[model samples]
Target chain A: YREFYQCDVDVIGSKSQVNELELVQIVDKVFGLLDVNVLVKINNRKVLTGFAEICGFPDKVVDITVAIDKLDKIGLESVEEEMREKGLTDGAIAVIEQILKLSGSTSEKLASMRSLMNGGSASGLVSETGLKGLDELEELFGLIDAAGVKCPVEIDLSLARGLNYYTGAIFEVKAVDFQIGSICGGGRYDNLTGIFGLPDMSGVGISFGADRIYDVLKGLDKFPKSLASSTTLLFACMGAEELRYVLPVAAALRSEGVSVEVYPEPSKLKKQFDYAEKKSIPFLSINGGNEAEAGTIQLKNLTTGEQKSFSKADISGMKAFMNM
Target chain B: YREFYQCDVDVIGSKSQVNELELVQIVDKVFGLLDVNVLVKINNRKVLTGFAEICGFPDKVVDITVAIDKLDKIGLESVEEEMREKGLTDGAIAVIEQILKLSGSTSEKLASMRSLMNGGSASGLVSETGLKGLDELEELFGLIDAAGVKCPVEIDLSLARGLNYYTGAIFEVKAVDFQIGSICGGGRYDNLTGIFGLPDMSGVGISFGADRIYDVLKGLDKFPKSLASSTTLLFACMGAEELRYVLPVAAALRSEGVSVEVYPEPSKLKKQFDYAEKKSIPFLSINGGNEAEAGTIQLKNLTTGEQKSFSKADISGMKAFMNM
Candidate 1:
């Protein structure tokens, strides 16, 4: 089973263009640091509603939009059949298809959409919401372009998020190099808290699918080397007497912000050293039964196999020697 | 309906004096920064086992430990009855009472225990595991004393953490000023991951109850003004088109590391201004219908009630004015 971890940032009582742009900026900063190229496509459910109105299926907007949104996966033919089953007419289906196919540069796309949907006829008036949506979409793009964001911001007309709450700009972020689906997504919801009796408030936020990002980074070999950073020293002891001699020395070094570990129990020297070797621990402090009586300790550099004995009385010298 | 958050740090795969003392130093740093006086009580489960074995309820270690651990909630008589039900003898009960009464400096207490348990055929060599535990506890305190950690550690013989996994040093941290229970607790478990088929490995860890800390700070009014830091500026808009003009400017300032919020929608000026006031938002950027065409914006400092108009071309000037 695959696990998912949610990394969400939310703003309460906000549903403005500035909020939308700031969210985009945050997304850019985080993923840019992760060195992942992305495509951020946006849509407005209101525009889909206008498309529904022009198709004479105003009341079935949810059904029509839901089916059309699955066109990428289930195919256009299957969506059309689903629409037919939902009581949408041939005109409605054609309008939906035309809107889904709408594409061009920011301004060109808006111009093409306006001309196709606005015929100066009654049905054209029915698509008034669609025309207004184009105006809002233009404003969103103008903000993105002026902000000089490097990532592409496409006007994906068929990108209808299935949630019924989104009222304005809706967003989905897709990784450019990975075959996975959208790794980050969110949008504006005008009256979510209204269900909790806090009406008319709007919010916009985004959630990063942390588990997916972890997988993608692992697959790309992008995780930083410091992820596995651990203790620099492992104190080795063969029995109870040795453990007593090294205890104070280990404690003194640890107080100075050093990462240190002590092997518990009086195990065999080889077994303990092998355990330290497997963890890639670089230094070993060994206090044998003889050393305990002598009040001395030995430091071994695991990497170079160097060993040196030090007087336990000169704790300061040991600190300097260990570079703690 | 209270809320809480946990902050967890673990020492996995080792249980050395160095690992244990380093954990103490980290805990000291955390609590020192938060500036709260705490009492850290230290104990060992192996000692608890010896106490149980000497109490003639060796097979009922779990039940006996669980009962006595609740001594703070229930009285001593209740614990005695629970021990008796587990088939404890009068000699065992007397030893249990003596253990309960044990206290002093770490070394002094251990020496007293040694004399009581080991001298003159008192309790059959004091159980080898119990003697081993005393040695471990002595080393632990030697490390603490050598480090000069500021927090006080109490050697509580009755402090048995009831978890099934812990094998060595158990710890509990409590704030001296608060009336709540231990806000942090953990211990060494020698074979936790072993249950997942990785045996003989040991780990030590502690978890800080962030929610409880938050409550404690809230009770003491210790959270500084900077804790709830939010954006300094809120761009207020008159209509959808006007919001388009201010979005990019907000984005640019935010990119420069200034926290910013865009007022959602172009509602009435009064409503937007009041919303800003409620959130204690400091500055208001008003780029309404007229300002949009002129390519200028109004900046209002809510704190000083000072308002000024500036050209959009003077974005650097606006940033300077807002102290970005």
Candidate 2:
């Protein structure tokens, strides 16, 4: 199926052996770091199959499902027209439309579907496969509750992911505040590996569209400011001799987990200071002939205009001065 | 030109305006961090052109250079055959072969080439364009020495990069210990952006092939072991209730810069331990019903088999324990 995010499966097994509850938990844990509100909408292909069978158009399942999948993009009128062109009777089209309009809290929707399946006029309409799909979704929701997933999990019957291979729960994640398509999507597929001569294997997966997520974060100004500067301190030298003296000190600071750089080529002091300023380097250390002989460095705080000399041995003090 | 690494130029200006000295300094500084021995080999297209002119076939410059570029891959006999096919006479081909065989220290090679250009009745045969190329190389070497670049710089006459666009210095970096092709390569292009409506823009750059460097580092076992694990601590809870209790604690640890994850779903203790072991998570914090009620967690060091109980206020202590 086409999706914005690249998909990767967590577990692969037969359709009946796919662990729906564990999948929900895994998704919940995976998305736990997001500060913004998110919704995980789930649906099942079997539900669509049962609905088509009950509507007396089981042979036209793929066509009906394909039309319904484009509902959001093409609207109800176009979907109905497409289904009609596929030879679906108006009555079967009406039944599919009613199911698409089903909505409520996850449990409330499940309850509504159950009543529709068992009510006198509608009784025996939903196939056993449809009931099994509803049961699987109910178990998934129950486990999600038990696991205390922070994100909302909704049973969106209208979310018919456009893929004929999906056999069980399909998941689509969307940001609550962002007006965009799904940031993540995936579903369970049966016998995917069977095409490669490994039979009966099923799999389920979800993937986050990293580029879209980055765009969203950028639009929201959520990126931390400190990420811009890789160098915490820059050593400004007066000449090649000073550079030679400062190289080892810079290397030692790097070894102590401090990101440091030595100004190559003894340029003008103003140019070196400008370089430090543009790079957002807070601390600038100068080891001229005097400092080099004394085994000390003159450290300047670009933000504060404060300067001090620290002995070469006091790396921790220098680190504290730089607030690294 | 196609290259293994993605090339990016630091300085761009007209051919005559671009400062070649600054380019050498920039390259020297950029590669200063590499601990392994590296050689920066330099050549010039103008020198190749001048050599072709002095050999009495200026119009065959491209053809002769193309043939010689394959010298390392196809050997001297094949290069001669290709040059012959390109219509270079035996005498001119002999001269080009002699130049290709010229080898020594960088300065010694320059001395030999200078004498070749002015020594015999063939003296003054080398054009001023070729002499200018020699002069640029001499200036680049002078600056490299003055800048005290740690890497060895070499001038090889046979180092003819196949690209016809290079107007000045061409560089290729080779790791001394590695058997792969050049890890980095680039050259000065006279009017690279001119084709895009920006005329006379000369640019010089070199690019490090990150994938090749990574492969070399991997083969040498130079990658740090700590890169394998992202999580420093994992909390293994007994049930959903304990999981809820551990979630906030894990978040707090994460806020303090300790990579932490809570075992989702409160799986079996053995399974949780196995996950921590496989992921190389050094610390496992357990907060079951009793520990949850006591507002403390029993943190175990998976590697050292040390266990200790810490209260909620002891996050700083746990940070120390994790060495994060």
Candidate 3:
């Protein structure tokens, strides 16, 4: 309801970390194609829950994640203050802070988080769930490395933005230069279909932020030039008889799969050319009394200002010229 | 709300008969492409009004045309009964019958109607509007003939189907063998925008009866086969490693504008093949452990049972085989 259009590319039925890598690669490829720089930040619900448990606040995972999600906006002090208000002691808060501040490459962050979780919390709580999520992250990053994803991927300990339904990897994509909020985001749901009376189906999905992507493409002026019009060639209407002479020829080129349009009226040459230019038609075929009488057409390349002659019957030749 | 969608192809600012001919030709081409046989029936409002005037019921043109429009379903006696109830004399009814029964080609029918209108009604009323509509119809058919429209075009004297705003040519297309009613219809409105306070701007438009055409296509089994999907090829997932082996290959083929899908699951070969068949994916790339290690792909043309081998790096060769 918050976004304009949400299309989930759901990779259902596989719990393999390969699916997680595929999602990362898709995020990379889509932004790469759009010429937008993006960072794919990933975290796991199990890992976040593990952090909460080792902090001796296992049942308060949601509260901890909600507060820390604001760490970037309100700063670490405010985040820790919110955690303390949720009934966390200073020792528990310090341990959680140490895990959140673990920064390095994906592998290095996973290693440090593993050692810190293994070191046990102030209340001596150990988290196997945290270790499991770290393993999944390591495998996902391994596959991502093998696939050579071009976009940057990050391990964000503070990301718990996906709805509480997600049981595994959580993905949040942000435009590096665009000021718009997350341009795309989704996560893994281990039992998404269980609420529908279907049990235990694991899926990973991502939704592209269609509205933000459009704004990004528009703001950046990255839309391909060819989408202006599919009209490959235009036949200028010089005279009624000339228009009559070229109709069949234009239809011929169209039948051969060349997009062709004939000026609807016998307007002035300047007007016809302007119309073609406005519609972004690349080539124009011009004919006058002499050419019509001789059964010939003068084809002009609007882009290059090159002119060539073709017999009125030569559809393939005209199409080849248009292609060239 | 009556039809699922009604898209009117409006040709504005052009009162030329060429535009009418183009509409007719487009109807012909669209129906031809859909593999549905259609009869393009044309009538002019002026000609209908002229008939009413010459019948001494110029003030009752709407009543007269409305009654006669039902003549095909209600029969001549019933239609004449309704006309008489609306205050037409026997003489006027006889003259109307004489004109309605005039059967011939478009040109011949136009000529006879012209003669009959010139002969005078019971009140000795003559209609130049009738002559003008007849003349326009003649020019329109002339263009249609010159363009060699493939579908049957008929001047239906009883046809007054389009709403009363039409000032010139009226069109209705019906499936030749289908039991349903008109599949497409429209007319020329000389002052369509006048009601909206934009006067004297004439336009010709036809709305394709999308719902009916879809039903017609379904009834006659006339829809094109390719519309079922845009996917050109599917890479079968035999195993995790094989799927990984083909992901980049699938991405490469996709970059070349080929619609390729790598089966998202490493299921049984039979299951993957069945999935391909169900999705109407034409060609499929298959690989097992041996093929994955050798960096080779076995491409299968599912429709033809032809299979070919290509190395993983030989994307162009694999694409060519798919094309073949």
Cα lDDT of model 2 by residue, A1-324, tens digit: 244445454567524222454455455655565455678888887777777777778877788778877888899899999999999888877777777777777788787776555431132465777777778777667656644556778876666666577888888888777777777777888777789997877776666677776666676566667787888898885875676667666756766788887675567899989999999988899877888789897888888999989998788888888886
- For each candidate, what TM-score against the reference? 0.70, 0.60, 0.83
Clashing pairs in 1: none
Better of 1 and 2 by DockQ: 1
Considering summed lDDT, which 10 consecutive residues are worst modelled in model 1 chain B?
A: B116-125
CA lDDT, candidate 1, residue A146: 64
State the weakest 10-residue window (summed lDDT) of model 3 chain A. Answer: A116-125
Which candidate tops TM-score? 3
State the lDDT of candidate 1 residue by residue for A97-160, as single tens digits: 7766767677887787777658632345457787787777877777777666768778776676
Tell me how far the alpha carbon of residue B298 in candidate 3 is from the true structure, in angstroms, after superposition.
5.1
lDDT of 3 at B167: 91
Pairs of residues clashing in candidate 2: A13-A202
Off by over 4 Å in 1: A1-15, A49-104, A120-126, A163-167, A186-207, A228-324, B1-19, B45-104, B120-130, B161-168, B186-211, B230-246, B267-277, B280-324
Clash number for model 3? 0
i-RMS, each model, one decimal: 4.9, 8.8, 3.3
**Residue-by-residue lDDT tens digits, candidate 2, B1-324:** 254545455557524212454454445555554444567888887777778877788888888878887888999999999999989888888878778888877788777776665532142366677778887787667656544556778875556665576888888878778787777777788888888999877777666677777766776676666778888888885875676666666756766678876665556789889999999888898888889899897888888999998897689988877776
